[model samples]
Target: MATTNVREITIALRSDGEGLLNSLVDELSRLAQEAVNFMKRTAPKWRSTLTNSIRADKISDFEWDIGPGVEYAPAVEEGRAPGKGLPRWEDPAAADIVQWLATKVFAGRRRARRTSMKAVHENLELRDRYQGLAWHVRHHGIKAHPFAAPTLDMMERSFPARLELAARRYLATTGSGGAA
Candidate 1:
Protein backbone atom coordinates (compact mmCIF):
# COMPACT_ATOMS: atom_id res chain seq x y z
CA MET A 1 0.00 0.00 0.00
CA ALA A 2 2.92 2.31 0.65
CA THR A 3 4.19 4.25 -2.34
CA THR A 4 7.17 6.38 -3.32
CA ASN A 5 4.89 9.43 -3.22
CA VAL A 6 4.38 8.87 0.53
CA ARG A 7 8.11 9.13 1.12
CA GLU A 8 8.37 12.19 -1.08
CA ILE A 9 5.50 13.89 0.71
CA THR A 10 6.98 13.13 4.10
CA ILE A 11 10.29 14.58 2.96
CA ALA A 12 8.53 17.67 1.67
CA LEU A 13 6.60 18.17 4.91
CA ARG A 14 9.80 17.95 6.95
CA SER A 15 11.58 20.69 5.00
CA ASP A 16 9.99 23.32 7.26
CA GLY A 17 9.52 24.49 10.85
CA GLU A 18 6.24 25.59 12.57
CA GLY A 19 4.81 22.30 13.90
CA LEU A 20 1.18 23.07 13.02
CA LEU A 21 1.85 22.19 9.36
CA ASN A 22 2.74 18.63 10.33
CA SER A 23 -0.31 18.35 12.60
CA LEU A 24 -2.57 19.18 9.66
CA VAL A 25 -0.88 16.50 7.54
CA ASP A 26 -1.24 13.92 10.30
CA GLU A 27 -4.98 14.65 10.69
CA LEU A 28 -5.55 14.23 6.97
CA SER A 29 -3.65 10.94 7.00
CA ARG A 30 -5.82 9.63 9.83
CA LEU A 31 -9.04 10.54 8.01
CA ALA A 32 -7.87 8.86 4.80
CA GLN A 33 -6.87 5.64 6.60
CA GLU A 34 -10.13 5.50 8.57
CA ALA A 35 -12.24 5.82 5.41
CA VAL A 36 -10.30 3.00 3.76
CA ASN A 37 -10.66 0.74 6.82
CA PHE A 38 -14.42 1.32 6.90
CA MET A 39 -14.78 0.38 3.23
CA LYS A 40 -12.66 -2.75 3.63
CA ARG A 41 -14.85 -3.99 6.48
CA THR A 42 -18.00 -3.64 4.31
CA ALA A 43 -16.50 -5.16 1.14
CA PRO A 44 -17.67 -8.71 1.88
CA LYS A 45 -21.29 -7.57 1.98
CA TRP A 46 -20.86 -5.91 -1.40
CA ARG A 47 -19.52 -9.13 -2.89
CA SER A 48 -22.35 -11.22 -1.44
CA THR A 49 -24.95 -8.82 -2.87
CA LEU A 50 -23.46 -9.13 -6.36
CA THR A 51 -23.32 -12.92 -6.21
CA ASN A 52 -26.83 -13.49 -4.85
CA SER A 53 -28.42 -11.17 -7.39
CA ILE A 54 -27.88 -13.60 -10.30
CA ARG A 55 -30.09 -16.46 -11.45
CA ALA A 56 -29.17 -19.53 -13.54
CA ASP A 57 -31.64 -21.21 -15.96
CA LYS A 58 -31.14 -24.99 -15.93
CA ILE A 59 -33.01 -25.73 -19.20
CA SER A 60 -31.14 -23.20 -21.38
CA ASP A 61 -27.96 -23.14 -19.33
CA PHE A 62 -28.16 -19.40 -19.39
CA GLU A 63 -27.68 -17.18 -16.36
CA TRP A 64 -29.92 -14.18 -15.90
CA ASP A 65 -29.11 -11.10 -13.91
CA ILE A 66 -31.62 -10.11 -11.27
CA GLY A 67 -31.89 -7.17 -8.93
CA PRO A 68 -31.80 -7.51 -5.16
CA GLY A 69 -35.60 -7.16 -4.96
CA VAL A 70 -36.13 -10.66 -6.43
CA GLU A 71 -37.45 -13.15 -3.90
CA TYR A 72 -36.11 -16.72 -3.59
CA ALA A 73 -38.17 -19.33 -5.50
CA PRO A 74 -39.98 -21.94 -3.40
CA ALA A 75 -39.16 -25.63 -3.74
CA VAL A 76 -41.63 -27.83 -5.71
CA GLU A 77 -43.08 -30.86 -3.89
CA GLU A 78 -42.88 -34.30 -5.53
CA GLY A 79 -45.73 -36.95 -5.52
CA ARG A 80 -46.46 -36.22 -1.85
CA ALA A 81 -49.36 -33.84 -1.24
CA PRO A 82 -48.30 -30.35 -0.11
CA GLY A 83 -49.48 -29.80 3.43
CA LYS A 84 -47.75 -26.53 4.13
CA GLY A 85 -44.83 -28.29 5.87
CA LEU A 86 -42.39 -26.23 3.83
CA PRO A 87 -39.94 -24.02 5.70
CA ARG A 88 -40.69 -20.31 5.82
CA TRP A 89 -38.91 -18.19 3.25
CA GLU A 90 -35.47 -17.18 4.36
CA ASP A 91 -35.05 -13.44 4.77
CA PRO A 92 -32.44 -12.05 2.41
CA ALA A 93 -29.83 -10.02 4.24
CA ALA A 94 -28.39 -8.74 0.98
CA ALA A 95 -30.91 -5.89 0.72
CA ASP A 96 -29.99 -4.58 4.16
CA ILE A 97 -26.29 -4.94 3.45
CA VAL A 98 -26.63 -3.26 0.08
CA GLN A 99 -28.60 -0.37 1.58
CA TRP A 100 -26.01 0.01 4.34
CA LEU A 101 -23.21 -0.04 1.79
CA ALA A 102 -24.99 2.53 -0.36
CA THR A 103 -25.18 4.83 2.62
CA LYS A 104 -21.56 4.12 3.45
CA VAL A 105 -20.51 4.79 -0.14
CA PHE A 106 -22.20 8.19 -0.09
CA ALA A 107 -20.78 9.05 3.31
CA GLY A 108 -17.34 7.83 2.31
CA ARG A 109 -17.40 9.83 -0.91
CA ARG A 110 -18.49 12.94 0.96
CA ARG A 111 -15.79 12.46 3.57
CA ALA A 112 -13.16 11.95 0.86
CA ARG A 113 -14.26 15.10 -0.97
CA ARG A 114 -14.20 17.07 2.27
CA THR A 115 -10.77 15.69 3.10
CA SER A 116 -9.51 16.65 -0.36
CA MET A 117 -10.75 20.20 0.08
CA LYS A 118 -9.16 20.41 3.52
CA ALA A 119 -5.86 19.17 2.09
CA VAL A 120 -5.99 21.79 -0.64
CA HIS A 121 -6.48 24.46 2.00
CA GLU A 122 -3.67 22.98 4.09
CA ASN A 123 -1.35 22.99 1.07
CA LEU A 124 -2.15 26.65 0.40
CA GLU A 125 -1.38 27.48 4.02
CA LEU A 126 1.91 25.60 3.83
CA ARG A 127 2.75 27.41 0.61
CA ASP A 128 2.10 30.72 2.33
CA ARG A 129 4.26 29.71 5.29
CA TYR A 130 7.12 28.65 3.02
CA GLN A 131 6.90 31.92 1.15
CA GLY A 132 6.90 33.85 4.40
CA LEU A 133 9.83 31.83 5.72
CA ALA A 134 11.78 32.45 2.52
CA TRP A 135 11.11 36.19 2.69
CA HIS A 136 12.19 36.35 6.34
CA VAL A 137 15.39 34.36 5.76
CA ARG A 138 16.27 36.45 2.73
CA HIS A 139 15.83 39.69 4.65
CA HIS A 140 17.36 38.48 7.93
CA GLY A 141 19.83 35.59 7.79
CA ILE A 142 19.47 32.56 10.20
CA LYS A 143 15.95 33.61 11.22
CA ALA A 144 14.26 33.76 14.65
CA HIS A 145 11.51 31.07 14.31
CA PRO A 146 13.54 28.31 12.62
CA PHE A 147 16.14 27.97 15.36
CA ALA A 148 14.30 29.69 18.22
CA ALA A 149 15.60 28.38 21.55
CA PRO A 150 12.13 27.89 23.10
CA THR A 151 10.78 26.14 19.98
CA LEU A 152 13.74 23.73 19.85
CA ASP A 153 13.38 23.00 23.56
CA MET A 154 9.67 22.30 23.14
CA MET A 155 10.40 20.01 20.15
CA GLU A 156 12.90 18.02 22.21
CA ARG A 157 10.46 17.70 25.06
CA SER A 158 7.65 16.46 22.77
CA PHE A 159 9.00 12.90 22.67
CA PRO A 160 8.80 12.06 26.37
CA ALA A 161 5.49 13.91 26.62
CA ARG A 162 3.76 11.63 24.06
CA LEU A 163 3.16 7.86 24.21
CA GLU A 164 4.15 7.19 20.59
CA LEU A 165 7.50 8.92 21.03
CA ALA A 166 9.43 6.81 18.54
CA ALA A 167 6.94 7.31 15.71
CA ARG A 168 6.90 11.05 16.44
CA ARG A 169 10.72 11.35 16.58
CA TYR A 170 10.65 11.95 12.83
CA LEU A 171 8.70 15.15 13.51
CA ALA A 172 11.62 16.91 15.23
CA THR A 173 14.18 15.61 12.72
CA THR A 174 12.06 16.72 9.81
CA GLY A 175 12.21 20.30 11.19
CA SER A 176 8.51 19.96 11.81
CA GLY A 177 9.08 20.85 15.49
CA GLY A 178 7.32 17.57 16.41
CA ALA A 179 4.06 19.19 15.33
CA ALA A 180 3.54 17.39 12.07
Candidate 2:
Protein backbone atom coordinates (compact mmCIF):
# COMPACT_ATOMS: atom_id res chain seq x y z
CA MET A 1 0.00 0.00 0.00
CA ALA A 2 1.11 3.52 -0.69
CA THR A 3 1.83 5.70 2.35
CA THR A 4 1.97 9.38 3.19
CA ASN A 5 5.33 10.91 4.09
CA VAL A 6 5.73 13.42 6.88
CA ARG A 7 8.34 16.19 6.96
CA GLU A 8 9.12 18.30 10.01
CA ILE A 9 11.29 21.16 11.21
CA THR A 10 12.66 21.34 14.70
CA ILE A 11 13.40 24.57 16.50
CA ALA A 12 15.26 24.74 19.74
CA LEU A 13 15.11 27.62 22.23
CA ARG A 14 17.29 28.48 25.20
CA SER A 15 15.32 30.00 28.04
CA ASP A 16 16.30 31.34 31.42
CA GLY A 17 13.70 29.40 33.32
CA GLU A 18 10.47 27.33 33.11
CA GLY A 19 8.23 30.43 32.78
CA LEU A 20 9.31 31.01 29.18
CA LEU A 21 8.45 27.50 27.93
CA ASN A 22 4.75 28.07 27.29
CA SER A 23 5.30 31.33 25.47
CA LEU A 24 8.10 29.77 23.44
CA VAL A 25 5.92 26.80 22.47
CA ASP A 26 3.11 29.10 21.45
CA GLU A 27 5.42 31.19 19.32
CA LEU A 28 6.91 28.10 17.71
CA SER A 29 3.46 26.77 16.87
CA ARG A 30 2.58 30.01 15.14
CA LEU A 31 5.82 29.88 13.19
CA ALA A 32 5.22 26.28 12.22
CA GLN A 33 1.75 27.14 10.98
CA GLU A 34 3.21 29.94 8.94
CA ALA A 35 5.70 27.54 7.42
CA VAL A 36 2.94 25.09 6.59
CA ASN A 37 1.00 27.84 4.88
CA PHE A 38 4.08 28.68 2.85
CA MET A 39 4.47 25.04 1.92
CA LYS A 40 0.85 24.86 0.80
CA ARG A 41 1.39 27.78 -1.50
CA THR A 42 4.59 26.20 -2.81
CA ALA A 43 2.87 22.89 -3.52
CA PRO A 44 2.17 22.13 -7.16
CA LYS A 45 -1.23 23.38 -8.28
CA TRP A 46 -2.46 20.75 -10.73
CA ARG A 47 -5.81 19.44 -9.58
CA SER A 48 -4.90 21.12 -6.28
CA THR A 49 -5.51 17.78 -4.60
CA LEU A 50 -2.15 17.50 -2.90
CA THR A 51 -1.87 21.20 -2.28
CA ASN A 52 -5.22 21.32 -0.52
CA SER A 53 -4.32 18.28 1.56
CA ILE A 54 -1.43 19.98 3.33
CA ARG A 55 -1.93 20.57 7.06
CA ALA A 56 -0.08 21.77 10.16
CA ASP A 57 -0.53 20.81 13.80
CA LYS A 58 1.40 20.79 17.02
CA ILE A 59 2.46 17.31 18.11
CA SER A 60 3.84 18.35 21.49
CA ASP A 61 5.08 21.35 23.40
CA PHE A 62 8.11 21.37 21.14
CA GLU A 63 7.19 19.32 18.05
CA TRP A 64 5.01 20.21 15.10
CA ASP A 65 3.70 18.44 11.99
CA ILE A 66 3.19 20.19 8.68
CA GLY A 67 1.61 17.22 6.98
CA PRO A 68 -0.15 14.15 8.26
CA GLY A 69 -2.33 11.28 7.02
CA VAL A 70 -2.13 12.61 3.49
CA GLU A 71 -1.88 9.39 1.54
CA TYR A 72 -0.62 9.89 -2.07
CA ALA A 73 0.93 13.18 -0.88
CA PRO A 74 4.40 11.62 -0.98
CA ALA A 75 3.80 10.39 -4.50
CA VAL A 76 3.05 13.92 -5.60
CA GLU A 77 6.00 15.27 -3.62
CA GLU A 78 8.61 12.65 -4.63
CA GLY A 79 7.08 11.14 -7.77
CA ARG A 80 5.86 7.60 -8.26
CA ALA A 81 6.23 4.65 -10.62
CA PRO A 82 4.04 4.52 -13.69
CA GLY A 83 0.52 3.28 -12.96
CA LYS A 84 1.13 3.67 -9.24
CA GLY A 85 -0.11 7.12 -8.28
CA LEU A 86 -3.43 7.58 -10.02
CA PRO A 87 -6.46 7.82 -7.76
CA ARG A 88 -8.79 4.84 -7.89
CA TRP A 89 -12.30 5.49 -9.10
CA GLU A 90 -14.90 4.78 -6.48
CA ASP A 91 -17.50 3.90 -9.12
CA PRO A 92 -15.89 3.62 -12.52
CA ALA A 93 -18.02 4.69 -15.47
CA ALA A 94 -16.79 1.72 -17.48
CA ALA A 95 -17.92 -0.61 -14.72
CA ASP A 96 -21.33 1.03 -14.79
CA ILE A 97 -21.71 0.13 -18.49
CA VAL A 98 -20.89 -3.49 -17.77
CA GLN A 99 -23.35 -3.55 -14.89
CA TRP A 100 -26.09 -2.03 -17.05
CA LEU A 101 -25.48 -4.59 -19.77
CA ALA A 102 -25.65 -7.43 -17.28
CA THR A 103 -28.94 -6.18 -15.82
CA LYS A 104 -30.66 -5.22 -19.12
CA VAL A 105 -29.37 -7.87 -21.51
CA PHE A 106 -28.66 -10.96 -19.42
CA ALA A 107 -30.99 -10.55 -16.45
CA GLY A 108 -34.08 -12.21 -18.01
CA ARG A 109 -32.32 -14.70 -20.23
CA ARG A 110 -32.95 -18.37 -19.53
CA ARG A 111 -30.38 -21.15 -20.01
CA ALA A 112 -32.02 -22.10 -23.35
CA ARG A 113 -32.01 -18.53 -24.72
CA ARG A 114 -29.04 -17.26 -26.71
CA THR A 115 -27.89 -13.65 -26.52
CA SER A 116 -29.29 -11.54 -29.33
CA MET A 117 -27.03 -9.75 -31.83
CA LYS A 118 -28.04 -6.37 -30.44
CA ALA A 119 -26.80 -7.40 -26.98
CA VAL A 120 -23.53 -8.58 -28.52
CA HIS A 121 -23.12 -5.26 -30.33
CA GLU A 122 -23.78 -3.29 -27.12
CA ASN A 123 -21.25 -5.45 -25.26
CA LEU A 124 -18.63 -4.75 -27.91
CA GLU A 125 -19.30 -1.03 -27.70
CA LEU A 126 -18.95 -1.03 -23.93
CA ARG A 127 -15.77 -3.11 -24.20
CA ASP A 128 -14.32 -0.62 -26.67
CA ARG A 129 -15.07 2.28 -24.36
CA TYR A 130 -13.48 0.48 -21.39
CA GLN A 131 -10.41 -0.36 -23.46
CA GLY A 132 -10.03 3.24 -24.56
CA LEU A 133 -10.11 4.51 -21.00
CA ALA A 134 -7.62 1.84 -19.93
CA TRP A 135 -5.32 2.66 -22.86
CA HIS A 136 -5.31 6.36 -22.00
CA VAL A 137 -4.53 5.68 -18.36
CA ARG A 138 -1.74 3.21 -19.17
CA HIS A 139 -0.16 5.58 -21.69
CA HIS A 140 -0.23 8.62 -19.44
CA GLY A 141 0.53 7.58 -15.90
CA ILE A 142 1.08 9.94 -12.99
CA LYS A 143 4.21 12.04 -13.41
CA ALA A 144 6.19 13.02 -10.36
CA HIS A 145 6.18 16.73 -9.57
CA PRO A 146 8.05 17.42 -6.38
CA PHE A 147 6.76 20.25 -4.19
CA ALA A 148 7.69 19.55 -0.56
CA ALA A 149 11.46 19.40 -0.87
CA PRO A 150 11.63 22.69 -2.70
CA THR A 151 9.27 24.28 -0.20
CA LEU A 152 11.46 23.03 2.62
CA ASP A 153 14.52 24.43 0.86
CA MET A 154 12.92 27.81 0.62
CA MET A 155 11.84 27.65 4.25
CA GLU A 156 15.35 26.70 5.34
CA ARG A 157 16.66 29.77 3.60
CA SER A 158 14.20 32.13 5.30
CA PHE A 159 13.69 30.38 8.63
CA PRO A 160 16.40 32.28 10.45
CA ALA A 161 14.73 35.60 9.69
CA ARG A 162 11.35 34.21 10.67
CA LEU A 163 12.75 32.76 13.89
CA GLU A 164 14.40 36.04 14.71
CA LEU A 165 11.15 37.89 14.15
CA ALA A 166 9.27 35.47 16.34
CA ALA A 167 11.85 35.79 19.06
CA ARG A 168 11.72 39.55 18.87
CA ARG A 169 7.94 39.50 19.16
CA TYR A 170 8.16 37.15 22.16
CA LEU A 171 10.68 39.42 23.81
CA ALA A 172 8.63 42.51 23.12
CA THR A 173 5.52 40.94 24.60
CA THR A 174 7.27 39.54 27.69
CA GLY A 175 9.48 42.63 28.15
CA SER A 176 12.38 40.31 28.93
CA GLY A 177 15.02 42.44 27.19
CA GLY A 178 17.69 39.92 26.14
CA ALA A 179 17.42 38.05 29.40
CA ALA A 180 16.23 34.69 27.98
Candidate 3:
Protein backbone atom coordinates (compact mmCIF):
# COMPACT_ATOMS: atom_id res chain seq x y z
CA MET A 1 0.00 0.00 0.00
CA ALA A 2 1.35 3.39 -0.98
CA THR A 3 1.19 6.33 1.41
CA THR A 4 0.28 9.99 1.24
CA ASN A 5 1.16 12.25 4.13
CA VAL A 6 -0.79 15.39 4.88
CA ARG A 7 0.98 18.60 3.99
CA GLU A 8 2.37 20.46 6.96
CA ILE A 9 1.95 24.17 7.79
CA THR A 10 3.21 25.85 10.92
CA ILE A 11 2.49 29.03 12.85
CA ALA A 12 4.83 29.82 15.69
CA LEU A 13 4.61 32.41 18.48
CA ARG A 14 7.23 33.11 21.11
CA SER A 15 5.43 35.53 23.34
CA ASP A 16 6.45 36.07 26.98
CA GLY A 17 2.89 36.93 28.05
CA GLU A 18 -0.42 35.12 27.77
CA GLY A 19 -2.31 37.92 26.04
CA LEU A 20 -0.38 37.72 22.79
CA LEU A 21 -0.35 33.94 22.93
CA ASN A 22 -4.14 33.92 23.31
CA SER A 23 -4.53 36.03 20.20
CA LEU A 24 -2.22 33.78 18.23
CA VAL A 25 -4.04 30.64 19.42
CA ASP A 26 -7.40 32.08 18.46
CA GLU A 27 -6.07 33.01 15.03
CA LEU A 28 -4.67 29.53 14.49
CA SER A 29 -8.01 28.01 15.42
CA ARG A 30 -9.76 30.29 12.94
CA LEU A 31 -7.28 29.39 10.21
CA ALA A 32 -7.69 25.69 10.96
CA GLN A 33 -11.46 25.98 10.75
CA GLU A 34 -11.14 27.81 7.45
CA ALA A 35 -8.88 25.10 6.08
CA VAL A 36 -11.30 22.36 7.15
CA ASN A 37 -14.25 24.19 5.66
CA PHE A 38 -12.33 24.76 2.43
CA MET A 39 -11.45 21.06 2.20
CA LYS A 40 -15.01 19.95 2.97
CA ARG A 41 -16.16 22.10 0.09
CA THR A 42 -13.38 21.17 -2.36
CA ALA A 43 -12.71 17.51 -1.57
CA PRO A 44 -14.04 14.75 -3.75
CA LYS A 45 -17.02 13.38 -1.82
CA TRP A 46 -18.03 9.77 -1.38
CA ARG A 47 -21.45 10.08 0.23
CA SER A 48 -19.97 12.98 2.26
CA THR A 49 -17.84 10.55 4.26
CA LEU A 50 -14.54 11.88 3.00
CA THR A 51 -15.56 15.50 3.47
CA ASN A 52 -17.00 14.88 6.96
CA SER A 53 -13.79 13.15 8.01
CA ILE A 54 -11.80 16.41 7.80
CA ARG A 55 -10.70 17.72 11.21
CA ALA A 56 -8.09 19.80 12.94
CA ASP A 57 -5.96 18.36 15.71
CA LYS A 58 -4.27 20.89 17.93
CA ILE A 59 -0.61 19.91 17.92
CA SER A 60 0.64 22.71 20.13
CA ASP A 61 -0.20 26.23 21.32
CA PHE A 62 0.13 27.57 17.79
CA GLU A 63 0.14 24.57 15.44
CA TRP A 64 -2.57 22.22 14.17
CA ASP A 65 -2.88 18.98 12.18
CA ILE A 66 -5.75 19.47 9.78
CA GLY A 67 -6.78 16.70 7.40
CA PRO A 68 -9.15 13.80 6.82
CA GLY A 69 -9.83 10.99 9.36
CA VAL A 70 -10.66 8.01 7.12
CA GLU A 71 -8.27 5.27 5.98
CA TYR A 72 -8.80 5.80 2.27
CA ALA A 73 -8.57 9.54 2.81
CA PRO A 74 -5.09 9.91 1.34
CA ALA A 75 -6.11 7.83 -1.62
CA VAL A 76 -9.12 10.04 -2.24
CA GLU A 77 -7.14 13.26 -1.79
CA GLU A 78 -4.02 12.25 -3.71
CA GLY A 79 -5.56 9.65 -6.00
CA ARG A 80 -4.06 6.25 -6.75
CA ALA A 81 -1.55 5.80 -9.49
CA PRO A 82 -2.27 3.26 -12.19
CA GLY A 83 -1.69 -0.43 -11.30
CA LYS A 84 -2.40 -0.07 -7.59
CA GLY A 85 -4.55 -3.18 -7.86
CA LEU A 86 -8.22 -3.64 -6.94
CA PRO A 87 -9.51 -3.41 -3.37
CA ARG A 88 -8.87 -6.60 -1.44
CA TRP A 89 -12.39 -7.56 -0.49
CA GLU A 90 -13.13 -11.06 0.71
CA ASP A 91 -16.52 -11.02 -1.02
CA PRO A 92 -17.25 -8.48 -3.68
CA ALA A 93 -20.93 -9.30 -3.33
CA ALA A 94 -21.05 -7.92 0.19
CA ALA A 95 -18.32 -5.37 -0.23
CA ASP A 96 -18.59 -1.81 1.08
CA ILE A 97 -18.76 -0.71 -2.52
CA VAL A 98 -22.48 -1.38 -2.64
CA GLN A 99 -23.26 1.89 -0.89
CA TRP A 100 -20.61 3.69 -2.89
CA LEU A 101 -22.17 2.38 -6.06
CA ALA A 102 -25.52 3.54 -4.78
CA THR A 103 -24.21 7.08 -4.46
CA LYS A 104 -24.43 9.29 -7.51
CA VAL A 105 -21.29 10.67 -9.07
CA PHE A 106 -21.32 14.34 -8.12
CA ALA A 107 -20.29 15.67 -11.52
CA GLY A 108 -23.16 13.99 -13.31
CA ARG A 109 -26.94 13.92 -13.36
CA ARG A 110 -27.26 10.12 -13.29
CA ARG A 111 -29.77 8.76 -10.79
CA ALA A 112 -28.43 6.52 -8.01
CA ARG A 113 -29.50 2.90 -8.23
CA ARG A 114 -30.70 1.23 -5.05
CA THR A 115 -28.07 -1.46 -4.53
CA SER A 116 -27.82 -1.60 -0.76
CA MET A 117 -29.90 -4.73 -0.08
CA LYS A 118 -28.97 -6.81 -3.12
CA ALA A 119 -25.82 -8.88 -3.38
CA VAL A 120 -23.49 -8.09 -6.26
CA HIS A 121 -24.41 -11.16 -8.28
CA GLU A 122 -28.13 -10.65 -7.69
CA ASN A 123 -28.06 -7.35 -9.53
CA LEU A 124 -26.69 -7.33 -13.05
CA GLU A 125 -25.97 -3.60 -13.28
CA LEU A 126 -24.35 -3.52 -9.86
CA ARG A 127 -22.17 -6.49 -10.61
CA ASP A 128 -21.12 -5.08 -13.93
CA ARG A 129 -20.42 -1.68 -12.45
CA TYR A 130 -18.30 -3.05 -9.60
CA GLN A 131 -16.36 -5.38 -11.85
CA GLY A 132 -15.76 -2.67 -14.37
CA LEU A 133 -14.52 -0.31 -11.69
CA ALA A 134 -12.31 -3.00 -10.23
CA TRP A 135 -10.81 -3.76 -13.62
CA HIS A 136 -10.20 -0.11 -14.39
CA VAL A 137 -8.65 0.57 -11.02
CA ARG A 138 -6.42 -2.47 -11.33
CA HIS A 139 -5.20 -1.41 -14.75
CA HIS A 140 -5.55 2.32 -15.27
CA GLY A 141 -5.17 3.38 -11.66
CA ILE A 142 -6.93 6.41 -10.17
CA LYS A 143 -6.02 9.87 -11.29
CA ALA A 144 -4.81 12.26 -8.60
CA HIS A 145 -7.51 14.67 -7.39
CA PRO A 146 -5.64 16.62 -4.77
CA PHE A 147 -7.22 19.12 -2.32
CA ALA A 148 -5.41 18.97 1.03
CA ALA A 149 -1.98 19.96 -0.18
CA PRO A 150 -3.41 22.69 -2.32
CA THR A 151 -5.38 24.01 0.62
CA LEU A 152 -2.21 24.24 2.64
CA ASP A 153 -0.61 26.05 -0.25
CA MET A 154 -3.45 28.52 -0.29
CA MET A 155 -3.26 29.06 3.49
CA GLU A 156 0.49 29.44 3.43
CA ARG A 157 0.19 32.16 0.83
CA SER A 158 -2.03 34.15 3.20
CA PHE A 159 -0.06 33.35 6.35
CA PRO A 160 1.73 36.70 6.54
CA ALA A 161 -1.58 38.55 6.49
CA ARG A 162 -3.11 36.24 9.08
CA LEU A 163 -0.11 36.59 11.37
CA GLU A 164 -0.23 40.36 11.03
CA LEU A 165 -3.92 40.35 11.82
CA ALA A 166 -3.32 38.30 14.95
CA ALA A 167 -0.55 40.65 16.03
CA ARG A 168 -2.75 43.66 15.39
CA ARG A 169 -5.55 42.16 17.50
CA TYR A 170 -3.07 41.53 20.30
CA LEU A 171 -1.72 45.07 20.08
CA ALA A 172 -5.21 46.54 19.98
CA THR A 173 -6.22 44.65 23.10
CA THR A 174 -3.11 45.86 24.90
CA GLY A 175 -3.55 49.47 23.68
CA SER A 176 -0.10 49.31 21.99
CA GLY A 177 -1.31 50.48 18.59
CA GLY A 178 2.12 50.64 16.98
CA ALA A 179 3.92 48.34 14.48
CA ALA A 180 3.57 44.56 14.88
Candidate 2 matches the true fold with a TM-score of 0.52
Predicted candidate 1 versus true structure: per-residue lDDT over 1-180, tens digit per residue: 533456555665656434534554454344334333333332223335432432322232121221122332111001123232221113363344234434543454433343588666644654454445435444554312111233234435642344245335655676544443
CA deviation > 4 Å runs, candidate 2: 1-16, 82-141, 168-176
lDDT per residue for candidate 2 within 13-68, as digits (tens), equals 23423445655676777778877788777777655666777887668888777763
Instruction: Pick the TM-score winner.
Output: 3
lDDT of 1: 0.38
lDDT of 2 at 80: 44
**Winner by lDDT between candidate 2 and candidate 1:** 2
lDDT of 3 by residue, 105-168 (tens): 2235444456754443335665566778888888898888787988888898986698788877
Candidates sorted on TM-score, descending: 3, 2, 1
Q: Cα miss at 117, model 2 (Å)?
A: 17
lDDT accuracy of residue 141 in candidate 1: 40
Model 3: residues >4 Å from true position, as ranges? 1-16, 88-94, 102-122
